[model samples]
Target: MPSAPIKAMIMAAGRGERMRPLTDNTPKPLLKVRGKPLIDWHAEALARGGFTDLVVNTAWLGEQIENHFGQQSQTPPSIAYSREGLDFGGALETAGGIARALPLLGDVFWLLAGDVFVPGFEFTQAAVDRFAAGGKLAHLWLVPNPAHNPKGDFGLGADGLALNLPKDSAEPRFTYSTIGLYRRELFEAMPFGNPQGLKAPLAPLLRAAMDNGRVSAQLYPGPWTDVGTPARLDELNQASTTY
Candidate 1:
């Protein structure tokens, strides 16, 4: 028998406060990047890797997102929505949203923020296989520190473990690419409060896991942009021809 399709979650629930007026009218993930919605790029990559079971958590004008994707059951890569706005009145941050959607996602799933732009990144079955063979709770893709985040987020050891370094530590740190393979246990053990509408950030959970040496990471030396502000979006559009 054929194996089950790998499950993945595309996080689209952010309010995009930095994006401002643009986000006031359009969801960040729906904003055009090279003439296509940002989330579509991730969906296409996951489809290529056979991660057809997808769950998208939405808030902040979520109806637009739902309308764009539609509620189709028989589609090749089936799409499901965890409407946090409708259920909870707002976004559930990152870890909370994932916990809310845990029923749909299985033991392991690919997790990525929908706002970042990484056009050439490929979601490969080989990556899923490698993560499955390991005992780590999460495998994150880290990128060189961007000018906006010079302090970076986490340190990566030569052994592939993610390090939760001290704030003043001079060790090299990298920005989380927000692309990763996750085991459900990372979220399951957390106290997410009431399930009806848990609100929490993902950093604390990731840092705790990192402290325990339960996370792994690798550097991604490729074109990537967080696309947080209007200026960044404009730059991407102006340079669209290069991509």
Candidate 2:
């Protein structure tokens, strides 16, 4: 049987309070990195990965996001928007946002953060085949912890399951790379319109899946930066130029 087409959702509705001034007028995803809008890199990456349908949720000066890339006919993956009006303020955290966009997200799709900068990482046909065969609810990309987040996010065991790190354990924790493939069923029970983030809903499901050996995680050695603050954004810009 032919594998299901890969779809993608770029989460881009945050006010970017940490990246003030620069985001005062423009949304964080619209912020320039290496002279290009941050989201542009993600859009191009997804298209290159063979994703044809793209859904982006926007708020907080969302008009700019729509104006620039709303109808990007030139891009391989056609882009669409799920506009959350000003009354909604900004992003509905993460899980809530995904829940709100379920109509557009099909069965299994990649969910990526808008501000993170990741280059040259594309989904492989073999990987997609494995994902389809395993019937897994989600597959995540984990990276080594950075200086800003030394504690990291989760633990990857030898069995390829993602386990929550012990609060008192001193072992190195692996950080979530903000790139993941998820099944819509995982978020089926989540309540929408609330600001609950992805963690609240995903953590339990991940833990359950880990116990049952359903979740899969891969180590990503490529360059990945969480461009949340101005300092990190500047660092990414500098790195792009120097390297």
Candidate 3:
């Protein structure tokens, strides 16, 4: 088996503007789908999958996230937080948040969104091992386009590299599931803040890497949901009997 990056980071800073009312006080990731918090699924899976260190970035109501897993430090997969808006205010966005958390995240790590529900997806050792051997800057999971986002984000080349081809470019495009494994160097030497953190999105950096043939991808034909809107949340809950 190839070597794997054991540390992981979950993006929990999104304000969830579309999920307001429910997200007004509770962070989107904390909102219950069936009976469990969305982020909890990731936490349990990461721990069960044998990951030893986990970092979570937060902004709006970040303390709740900290409180929920306050004792994780005393356990396995030791948890760390990259709190935003306490000294700076607002979130650091995805890439910015990841950069700020690099000290905890280390050189290579798994990065996943907290709001996405991928119940069957496992934080498998084989996936991590393959990623470490690929020498790529990033690896992403691409899912079939959901209704809310039909145009999709990137295309998968025969070599497994993500391509930023135009929507009509003829290459099959798919939605970014917001789950990835990344190398730290991808965020370095950029016009961005360091320890203090700054506001920025992740897509531009990813596209740049793809241009250099540094990002690979895989098509995940499994259950997944973005949970962006309240109605979508209801649909999930109504469609499920288990949390």
Best by TM-score: 1
TM-score of each: 0.93, 0.88, 0.93
Candidate 2 per-residue lDDT, tens place, 27-108, comes to 9999988888888899877766677688988888888988787466674457777766453555666776777777777777
Q: Candidate 1 vs. truth: CA RMSD?
A: 2.3
Q: Which portions of model 1 show Cα errors greater than 4 Å?
A: 1-3, 71-76, 191-194
Q: Quote the RMSD, in angstroms, for model 2.
A: 2.9
Question: How far does residue 105 in candidate 3 sit from its true spot (Å)?
Answer: 1.3
Which runs of model 3 end up more than 4 angstroms from their true locations?
1-5, 71-77, 191-193, 241-243
Best-to-worst ranking by lDDT: 1, 3, 2
Clash statistics: count for each candidate? 0, 0, 1
Provide the clash count, candidate 3: 1
> Model 3: per-residue lDDT, tens digit, 1-243?
446548889899889999999999999999987788999888888877878578888889989988887745556357788777675688888888888778777677999999999887888788887887778999999999999988899999998899988888777799999888899989995543366566678899999999999999999998899999999899999994453
TM-score quality measure for candidate 2: 0.88
Name the better of 2 and 3 by TM-score.
Answer: 3
lDDT, candidates in the order shown:
0.88, 0.77, 0.85
* Model 2 C-alpha lDDT versus the unseen true structure: 0.77
Who is ahead in TM-score, 1 or 3? 1
